[model samples]
Target: MRKEGIAKRGEKNKTTIRKILNYISKYKGMVLASVILAAISVVFTLYIPILIGQAVDQIVGPGQVNASALFVILKKILVVSLITAGVQWMKNHINNRVTYYVVEDIRTKAFNHIQVLPISYLDSHPSGDIVSRIITDTDQFSEGLLMGFTQLFTGVTTIIGTLLFMLSINPVITLVVVAVTPLSFFVARFIAGKTFTMFKCQSETRGAITALTDEMLGNLKVVKAFSHEQEAQKEFEEINERLAGYSMKATFFSSIVNPATRFVNSIVYAAVGVIGALFAVKGFITVGQLTSFLNYANQYTKPFNEISGVVTELQNSIASASRVFELIEQPALKEETGDSCVLGDAQGYVDMQHVAFSYEADKKLIEDLNLHAEPGQRIAIVGPTGCGKSTLINLLMRFYEVNSGTIKIDSMDTRKITRESLRAGFGMVLQETWLKSSTVRENIAYGKPDATEEEIIRAAKEAHCDSFIRRMPEGYDTVLGEDGGMLSQGQKQLLCIARVMLCLPPMLILDEATSSIDTRTEQKIQNAFAKMMEGRTSFIVAHRLSTIKEADVILVMKDGNIIEQGTHQELLAQNGFYTQLYNAQFAR
Candidate 1:
């Protein structure tokens, strides 16, 4: 399993690298500048050794020291150092700009892509992991790009220039230096390959820790109520331990890379010195030449050490990039292809023909279902838990596609219309009301951003929440806590209804909209819902029979099929499934 995971990760890394490179292609000028600066810096660096050799030969080794020549060489060396510093600074500046913007572009695309993903994708992936990909993985890519590109560009230029200089002095010694290059590369590659798995594991474990922490914080009320503080702490400690263990393994391998490279480099340096000394004594090499060769040998070994360090960084980056790209590459939910058509002055006719759907293939949630609602009609669906009531609403909203049937609005198949156009025709108040941490007025006006104070108040009054809202210190401008934690469940539901009412869509869906309210509040909400449902098509999925008694149509569902359908009066008259359910409930 671990090997398979590593292989899959490697493939993903390759794909991500391609995508990153493609993004970078847009900033070709900046990349070119960086490369040029890097090459210039390396060339200037190579001059330092030559300047030293010239100083040794002209000033320190001859019968008489040449002061003028020494001054000229010193001036040249100073100029080269200054040029090298300036080029390196430019390289860093250009690389930083390129890396930062590329990361920003990728992050924006990833975030936008997430918004268009189907609800099913979110359902399958953990929220924490998704969040980590966006935040942590993207950060890794930024760091990796900066460090990796800098070292890679500089290292290659330095190695090439140094080898050419060494060969100029003594080809034999240069050959010996070149021979060790392959061995260093092989060792670095071996270590990198072995450590890749640890890096991946560490990333996964870190994501898990993030997810667990988020989950705990989100459900802090429940945790406190159950007094599971100790248990939660223990669970967190265990996750932290696992993450630390994987991190340690990854770090351990990374730490070994530099030292190992240095050791190999030390051996190479010793061999070069010994060989140069023997050649010098045999009159085969000059002292100045030997000095130059030694300088080049040190220069050559620097790339190996730098490359070893970068390999570790690259491995971590590749792991992070793989996860990030996986999310970015996920196919977005199929979008409507045709031009968007508005439902202007819509009459809200809806029909579902032989609809079939399943979250998974083997377990069908809604099967071979048929339903219809005329313009300006109110329909209610009632069933036991897991009986496809919510699934039906999901299909109507086009959140999920029907497997073997069609849903249509005014004879237009839903798939033929853009999601924005199709959904714009409806209003929804879900059971789990979601409110952003914003002003109360903003939350109410979410459906209509341009709504005025008067219009917002009118909608709030209709939803029966205006009076209570006005009593608050800040009224409509009051800032809500996360998910509206400052408000009661019933108040939150009322606010959600007000939000929906503000939109005034031709159709409204109330899925357990009254479940969170008390009996008195439910009555007020029912009145508001009735007012909203007037002159519109509406679907109500509720367990409460009283709430749907006035509905134009009621469908009794069981096990993914509608077993009974009629008006509330007609179903009661039949005394069948609907009648039995009504009796059992009222009998309680």
Candidate 2:
């Protein structure tokens, strides 16, 4: 089982590394430069100890040693060291540049992909997971890529070169030092493998904590209203404790690696010293040669330790990379066909034939429904909660796919039309209007980003929001708080209506659009709605029959099927579902 688990982990690591490589491919020139500089720096570092050994041998030799020659050698060594430092500095600079650019590219791709994902994907995934992908996952790539490659490359090169030089100096001492290499590697690998699992657990636990916090903060109003602050705090504390436990486990395993490697290294060094002394005393090797061998032994051990350290970091980074790659690997929403139909000068005729849909396959939400609306018609859909009134609008907008049916606009199948073009021809105003924190003019102009001030003012006027907006402290220039917190629900809804009006689409959808406003404001909004729907098709989904009294058609839906359809008066006369619904509300 452990072998199987290790295989799975290795495969995951390979996949994630491939993705990281692909990201780096975009900046090939910079990466190439960094690699070249890193190689040069490593070669110079190895040369330093060899030069020191040479200086020591010359100084201790019987032949006259010229001070000037020694000075020249020292100067040359200093220059080489400076050059190596310069290369290293440049490598770091280029690595950071590449890291930042690659990170930016990944972030942009993730965000853009999220925007294009089908609504069903968002419905299935938590918002916190998505946020973690953008923030935490990307940050991991940034941190790892910046230093992981340079360290791995340089450490390997330095170790190999030092080993070769040490072997050339005295093969016996080199053998003694090399004997401990495998043991060090085994210890490092064991600790790294265990720590990696802990790190993965830590990351998952952190994501859960983030999700819980986001949920609580998002519903702060409800929590406060119900006096549930202590409950929330307790929940948060539980998550926090879970995160801390996992973090400590990961840190403990990581901390063991260095100490274990260092202890083994000390033992190896002691063995090398004893073996060198024996060789020198037996006249098998000279004092100078033994000294050089000892230096090389120390050199080898240091890089070995450094390599072990790098490996630990690399393992942690691989864990993070796996998470990031998993997110990127999710199937993106299918793109619109190249030859998809486009809505141009459409008359807003809509038809649904044998329509069926389900959020999940076995649990259908809407089934075998049929409906039609002609140009310039007003239709209202009414039903109890969970009766799929909103689901119908969702299908119309192609937010979710129809299971086994067809929906057409202006005689063009929706499946054959691009999603952007299909949605472009409709104006939507929902019950909870979402406004960004921006100036009033910016919010109103969201429907038409390039709209002029005059056009903005006209849309606001048409929505009956101009009078109140004009009285605001800064009029159109006022900055709204997040989600339009500074405005009343009625005012926010009005702004949303104005935003839709600015688009001037051929078809309009008002989903409980007036449910938040006062009766007087609802009347005014209804008047504006009637004006806007004068020459366009409209669909109003409402629970209150009074709001749809003037609709040309009323459809009563239940259990994903339409049970009644007719004019308001006709439905009332029939005394069926629609009639009963109306009577119940009127009686109340």
Winning model by TM-score: 2
TM-score of each: 0.93, 0.94
Candidate 1 per-residue lDDT, tens place, 1-588, comes to 988976876787777678779999999999998888888898889989888888777766447898899899999999999989988998998888998998899899899999999999998888998999889988987898888778988998899999888888889988988887677787898899878888888888888888888889988989999999999999999989999999999999889888888888888898899999999899888777788788889999989889888888888888887888889889999765656565565678898999999999987678889988898899999988889999898898889899989998998888887788778888999899999999999999998999999999999998889999999889999999999967998899999989998899999899999888889878877887887789999999999898899999998999999999999889989989888889988986
Q: In model 1, which regions exceed 4 Å deviation?
A: 1-13, 58-66, 226-238, 281-289, 339-341, 467-474
The positional error of residue 130 in candidate 2, measured at the CA in angstroms, is 0.6
What digit string (tens of lDDT, one per residue) describes model 2 on residues 76-135?
A: 789989999899889888878988998899888888878877788888877886787678
Give each model's clash number. Answer: 0, 0
Minimal lDDT window, size 10, model 1: 336-345
